[model samples]
Target: MQTKLRSRTITKPRSHHGKPAQSLVARRLPAKRPPTHPGEMLLEEFLKPLGISQSAFAVRLGISFPRLNEIIRGKRRVTPDTALRLAHVLGMSADFWLGLQQDWDLWHALRSKQAAAIARLEPLRHVS
Candidate 1:
């Protein structure tokens, strides 16, 4: 008999913003939403604690210094591939990085001119 391996998904109980037991449906927006970039967390939480320099960490991740610098400066977004690299080196899951990027993007978008325009858009149909 052959054994079957299955993958499982684990959801975090708390968000980085310090909410506990965050529900999936009707996601709660933070009381005072501050768009925090992943780069800030990466620098303060990971790099600072690990004592890893930006240039050195870039070499460890097999990426260029300028690229890593941009990421650290919040000028660049962390893609899935970059998330994987970060996960490999930082001993964290790729989802963590992606989630950070997503949270920041959502918060930023909510305050953009495009969001105001989008608010004017009406729903196509009501299926309910």
Candidate 2:
């Protein structure tokens, strides 16, 4: 008599971040989608809802009006220190601001001309 074996499939659980892991093919060439800047989120979700003016919010955060304006316009990237300050004033986590900045920066950078140029560079070979 011979024993028969049954095949089984195992499924991976979704990530804690709420997004499902990309399939192998999807990972190679991710779909191109524009990411919303953290500044936009701040303006629409926070400032507008709270009826806060840019100047007033800037003063509350202890940052210059111009600096806050630049951020609101998505001209400048948020530094870790600035993230902490925003988080403190908004009663949000520093990681929340930092993560938004990071995601915004990375998406923009990846979609830039520099990223295309970098992709054309030859890869280094492994040393023996």
- RMSD to native for every prediction? 10.0, 10.8
Q: Residues 10-127, candidate 1, lDDT per residue (tens digit)?
A: 3333433455432332322343775568888899988999998999999999999998889889999999999999999888899989988887776676567785466555657878
Q: Which 10 consecutive positions of candidate 2 have the poorest summed lDDT?
A: 21-30
- Which parts of model 2 are misplaced by more than 4 Å? 1-30, 124-128
**Model 2 agreement with the true structure over 18-126: per-residue lDDT tens digits:** 5543221111112366567778888999999999999999999999999988988999878888898999999989898877777677666656778646555566789
> What total of clashing residue pairs does each candidate reach?
0, 0
lDDT for each candidate structure: 0.74, 0.71
| TM agreement with the true structure for every prediction | 0.73, 0.69
